[model samples]
Target: MSVRSSAGRVRCPVCARPQAQCLCSLIPRLWPPTQLLVIQHPDEASHALNTARLLVPGLVNAHLLITESLQEHPAWMRRLQDPRWRNELLFPGEQAQVLLPAAVDLRPRRLVLLDGTWRKARKLVYLNPVLQSMAQVCLPAGLVSRYRLRKVPQAGALSTIEAGAEALSVLHPGFDKHALLAPFEALIEGQIRAMGLARYQQNYGAASDPAVE
Candidate 1:
């Protein structure tokens, strides 16, 4: 058989299924009313196998924002006009905390997700004056990051999907966050395995593996 025949019709590197015949629907759904917006660094968008993409299927009101600068993006201006919503940037700082939307009286229930490397994330905050004024929510957990493709400055830094699920669970309890998170974790793990990064499959590539390094 030719290589094309061997690989099947546009096979996915991870699930070994065709792009249109994906088993993603076999996974559960976590449809929260809370609006989710993911802002990705341009570089991350190019290089990432990005677990964040899985989120769009599960979320009812989610959007992906990509730009070199948050301040210059036209979407930033449009989102601001949404009077029914209030936003919070998920970051780690002295002020970061878990805040309920009701506690802040933020309407339309908004969450602005940042999907990028640690350096890019720092830049997102440093360059965007609008993000500075928003509330900052930090995750409080003993969990380390689940991303194995890139190195992070801190263990607390999590992948885009993991961070979003954690934040939503905090904002709304019993929100079936696992439905969204499990599939994402599987997808990430599958990608690492397909790339022959067995260390990533085992323990997020933390287990002293030269191949992943």
Candidate 2:
């Protein structure tokens, strides 16, 4: 087995590929007109299977803040106070009732996505009191997470891309969830194959050889 990745290929620890040719694109991009902010755990950012970076570049208005703790960050606090955007955190709490964007009229359009492990996410919410007060929206999907690399504590907690697109779709019911997700998944799948991950190839790609059928 090839333990080391070649040039132009990345070593995805989950799928196990090198950086130059990473298949992270298989995760979808949420392209809503609303302002988007993703605060990811800094440790999570270095993980090979992470998909947060893929989201930031695709959006017209998006910001990705990778930090271990955001509670004392002046910049993070300042951004939260930006009156131009009506901010909401993408976290579901027992105390937080389910919010449908259509039911309420929020003037400025914005959403904050927390991307990380369940433990890290919980820490993020607990440490940031400001985020706790933000309107919370829980995803209503019965679908399992498409992220096969990491084990989630709950089946419902989806990948970063999935969560982002789902949140946007709820905000705008007519949004295309599939379009946002397909390209990114394709990219991830492609990169995984390039790194010699056979499982992703069989599960997500066209075929090793179309004629084999």
Candidate 3:
């Protein structure tokens, strides 16, 4: 079997990518009206491809919580239950509404995003009743994901950082969402270059577009 990566590469303390390809410069420090709570699944917490790890440090007030359940974290549970801020979950479902700038209230808000695969995100939502109780929102239609490194089975699916950027921009319309995506795009391009043209073409670009995000 082929190994995807070396076990002991020196990784950047912030973005967690290899030190040579550290994405710290590309990451911006931005503050939005809403506080971000990125709930990452424990299984992928240490994965090199994990975007949630990169995202939390970029934003000034963002926090990353790696857990399968919320009941264990009393502080986070209280924040989620905080009556002052509106709690919103960035996930799509039959009942999910499109996340729009006009739709979001100006009041302080708590945006909860699940960082994991579709299945794992579903499982997180199922396991946490507080996540289920929050208002669920989806990204606008026709948004193409720039995360070419990952194959998303679902169309219009975005990586966690991508979703966070878009959602934050919509929540606070003044900031450009693309600033947040610079490091993410840089990471993808670096990985693609490392994979080489032949391998990337064979694995990612065999189709007219890509398979998906």
- Per TM-score, the best of the predicted structures is 3
- Cα deviation of 96, candidate 3, in Å: 1.0
Candidate No. with top lDDT: 3
The stretch of ten residues in a row with the least summed lDDT in candidate 3 is 204-213
Global lDDT of each model? 0.68, 0.68, 0.82
Please report the TM-score between candidate 3 and the true structure. Answer: 0.90
Candidate 2, residues 1-213, lDDT tens digits: the string is 324544545364332435455444554345576778899887687666566666666565778887766765888787786776677777878765554775465567778888888888888888887787787777775857666545567768788877877777777789877776664566545545555656555565635633122
Clashes of 2: 21
Local accuracy of candidate 3 as per-residue lDDT tens digits, 51-82: 88668887898999999999999899888888
Model 1 has how many clashing residue pairs? 0
Clash count, one per candidate? 0, 21, 0
The TM-score ranking, best first, is 3, 1, 2
Least accurate 10 contiguous residues by lDDT in model 1: 1-10
Report the alpha-carbon TM-score of model 1 versus the true structure.
Answer: 0.74
Write one digit per residue (lDDT tens) for candidate 1, span 1-213.
Answer: 111224345644432345654546645555677888888887775453566666655676777777757667767756754566776777886688855546757477778877777788878878877777778888876767655666767767778878888878887888877787766666555566566655455555355544333
lDDT of 2 at 125: 87
Whole-structure CA lDDT of model 1: 0.68
